[model samples]
Target: MIRAATDTGTFVPRIPLGEWVDTAVDWVTATFDPLFDGVKAVFETLYDGLDWALATPPFAVVALVLAALALWVKGWKLGLGTLVGFVVIAGVDQWANAMDTLALVLLATLVALVLGIPLGIWAARDDRVSRVLRPILDFMQTMPAFVYLIPTVVIFLTGPVPGLVATVAFAIAPGVRLTELGIRQVDAEVVEASRAFGATDSRVLRQIQLPLALPTIMAGINQVILLSLSMVVVAGLVGAPGLGAEVVASFQRIDVALGAEAGLSVVLLAIYLDRVSSALAERAPVARALAAAR
Candidate 1:
C-alpha cells in the first residue's frame, strides 16, 4: 500500500535564521559603534570602581564589612555565615576572584535597576507603553542567557564590560515587569484620593503609587541580583574575570577541585546576596506601613 502525504517527512524552510541574526547584529554594530563604546566605558568605570573598593581593602577588613552588612540586613546567623564563607574563600586563595565576581554582579544589578525601574514606571502609567514592552520583556526573560552575549560581543568585544552589558540585558526584564506590576497593583482609590487632594500626576505617582508599590519593586531588585549572579559562570566564557573565569579555567584544565572550590565560592556569594535582598524586600512593607501611619 502507498503511504499518504500525511506520512511524508516534515517540510524544511529555506530561511536562514542564523544568517539573518548575524547580519542584523553586524549592521547594528557598524551603525552604533560609538554608542557601544560609550556604554563600555561607563560599565568599565563602574566595574573598576567597585573592584578597586573591594580589592584594595585588606581581606580581613573586606570580610568584616561584608559580615557587618549581612548582619545589618539579615541578622546574626547570616552574618556569621557570611564571615565564615568569606574566610573560607580567602583561605582557598579565591578571595580576589570572589571579589571580582561580586563587583560584576553588583554593577550589573545597578544598571538593571536604573534602566528597568524607569521603563517599568513608564509602562505602568501608559497602556500603549505597557503593550509594547510586554513582548520585549518576555523576549528578554525567555531568551537563552548565552544569546545575549552574542550581540554584546560583536558591539563591545569580549571582556568583563561586554559580559556585564549582556548580563544587564539578560537580567533586567524582571525589574521592569515587577515594577510595572507593583505600580499597577496600587489601589485605584488611593490614587484618586491623592489626585482629588489637588496632587498633580507626578505627585500622585511619587507619594501614593510608588510608595505603595515599593515592596514589589524591592522584590524585583532581589530577582535582578539573583539573575545577575546566575550569569557569572556563563559570562566568564567571554572573558568576564571572577569566580566564573576560575570555573571556566578549571573546566578547561579538567581540574575538578578548583572548579568545586570556585563553584562553592559562587554559592556562598549567592546565598549571602539572596538572603540580604530578601530581608530588605520583607522590610519594605513595614517601611511603607510606617510611612502611612505617619
Candidate 2:
C-alpha cells in the first residue's frame, strides 16, 4: 500500500492569510471605486503630459538639453557621456521607448517623494509614528518586488497605470526611511537653539532642518530614482511601455540584439541619473548656502 499524495504523517493547520487579503482587497475595491478612478485620472494626465513633453521635442534637441544639464551639475565629462548615450539610443531607433521609460521613472519618483518625504518627517517628529512605520517599511523593502504587481493588476488591470502604481509601491520605502533618518540626524542642540530664538516648529524645519538634511534627502531621492528605474522593467510585464517592454519583447522572441539595445539604453539612463544625483547630494547644505548668499 502507498500513502495518498494528500496524506500527511502529522496533522497541520493551514493559514487563510491569502484568502483574507483577497477579501480585504475586494471590499476596498468595491468601496473605493470613485477614489481609485480619481487617482487614475490624475495619474493618466500626469503621464500623458510627461510623455508628450518628452516626445514632442526633436531627439537632438532633447539630447542636447540633457547633456547641458549633466554638464552643469557634474562637469563636461558627464555632459559628453550623456550626449553620446542618447546618440547611441537614437542610432538604435529606441529613442521613443527610452523617453517613455524616462517619463515613467520621473513620474514614479515624483509620486514617491511627494508621499514619502512627508511621512518621513512625521515619523521623525514622533517616536510612535517611527515605531509604527519601521515594521511597515521593513515589510515593504523586504517583500519581493514582483509581489507589488499582483494587487495593482487586480485593482487597475494591465497597462501603464498598474505598472506605475506597482513601481511606486515597490520603490517608496527608501525615500521615507532616508528622509526620517536625515531629519533625526540633525543636531538636537541646533533645534533647541532655533526654538530658543523664537523659531516655530515649522520655521525650524524649513530653515534649519531641511537645509542641513538636504544632502541626505538628496541621497534618498537618488535611491528613489534608481529603484523606480529598476521597477520599470518589472512593471513592463504589465504592459508598461519603454525599454522594459522592449526587453520583455526581446525575451519573448529570444532576440539578443533587441535585448542588448534596450539594456544598453537603460544602462545609459541609469548612469546619467546616478551621476547627476550623486553630484547634487554632495553639494553644500542648503540652508547655509542660502544664509551665505544673504
Candidate 3:
C-alpha cells in the first residue's frame, strides 16, 4: 500500500544541534584549561579584595565612607539616603550578604566596561564592524539568562567562578551597544572641523568625540551596572554566596521574613548604585568644543 502524501511524518531527519554544541564546548574546555585558570585567579583576587574591603569594616564605618562618596558625587540628599539604606540593610542582618553581592556586581561591571568601551569605539569608527556585531549582540541580549549558566557550569563547575563568568557574559552587551551609540551620536561637523584644524583621529576622539559623548557613555555604564547587580544575584543559585543565597533559601524553605529581608536588601543596594550612576551621567561635562561649535 502506498503512503498518502498527507502523512504527518516529518521528511527531514532530526538535527543533533545540541550534540554539536556539546562537542564544541568539550573541545574548548580541554584546550583552554590553563587560560581559564588564569582568568579565574584574576577574578577571584579582585573579588576577594572587594569582599575584604567591604566586609572587614564596621558596618557604621563602611556606611559612612560610602555616604561620603555619594556626597562627593551627587550631594547631601543621596549621601543621607545611602547612609540610611545601609543602616536598614544592616538592621535586617543582611549586611554581609549584601556586601558580597555588591562586590560581584562591581567587579563584573568594571570588566564589562574595560572590554566594552574600546570595542564600542572601534565599532563607531567602522561601519563594517558595527554591522557584524549587531546580530551577535542581539543574540547575547535575547538569550535567556539561565542558558548562560549551562556552558559556564559545565566548564568550571558550580561556584562564584562559574557564576562570575556567566554574569559577565550576561551583562556585557549594553555597554558595547551604548558606547557605540554614544560615540556615533557625536556631532559629525564638530569632528570634521577638528580634523580640518589639524587634529588627529586620536586627538579628535579624546578631546571632542568622547567628551561630548560622555552623557550617553555614562548612561551605558549605568545599564552595565544595573544588569550586573541582577545577574550576580541570580549567580547565587550556583553556590555563590550573597543576598541571593538568602533570597533562594527563603523560596526553598518558604520563609516569609527571610525573603522580605533579603529582597529589601537587594532593592536598597540596587537603588544606591543606580542613583550614584545616574547622578554621574548628569554630571558629565558639557564639552567646550561642542558649545563653541554650536
TM-score of 3: 0.93
Task: Return the TM-score for each candidate structure.
Answer: 0.93, 0.93, 0.93
Candidate 1 lDDT tens digits, 1-294: 233355567554456778898999899888988988888888888899999999999999999988998898878998999999898899889999999999999999998999999999999999999999999988888999999888887788888998998889999999999999999999899888888889999998887889888888999999999999988668998999999999999999999999999999899889989999987876776465766889
- For model 1, state the Cα shift of residue 7 in Å: 9.0
The segments of candidate 2 whose C-alpha lies over 4 angstroms from its true place after superposition are 1-9, 284-294
Give one digit per residue, the lDDT tens place, for model 3 in 116-230: 8898999999999999988999999999888888999887787777888888888888889988999999889999999999999999999998988887888889999999888
**Candidate models: Cα lDDT each:** 0.90, 0.90, 0.88
Residue 77 lDDT (model 1): 96
Name the lDDT of candidate 1. Answer: 0.90
- The residue-level lDDT of candidate 1 at 258 comes to 99
Candidate 3 ranges beyond 4 A from true positions: 1-12, 287-294
- Candidate 2 per-residue lDDT, tens place, 1-294, comes to 243446766545666789999999999889998988888889889998999999899998899998999998878999998999989999999999999999999999999999999999999899999999999999999999889999888888887888899989888999999999989999999999999999999999999888788878888999999999999988889899899999999999999999999999999999988998887776556744755789
Give the range where candidate 1 is weakest over 10 consecutive residues by summed lDDT: 1-10
Q: List the residue pairs that clash in candidate 1.
A: none
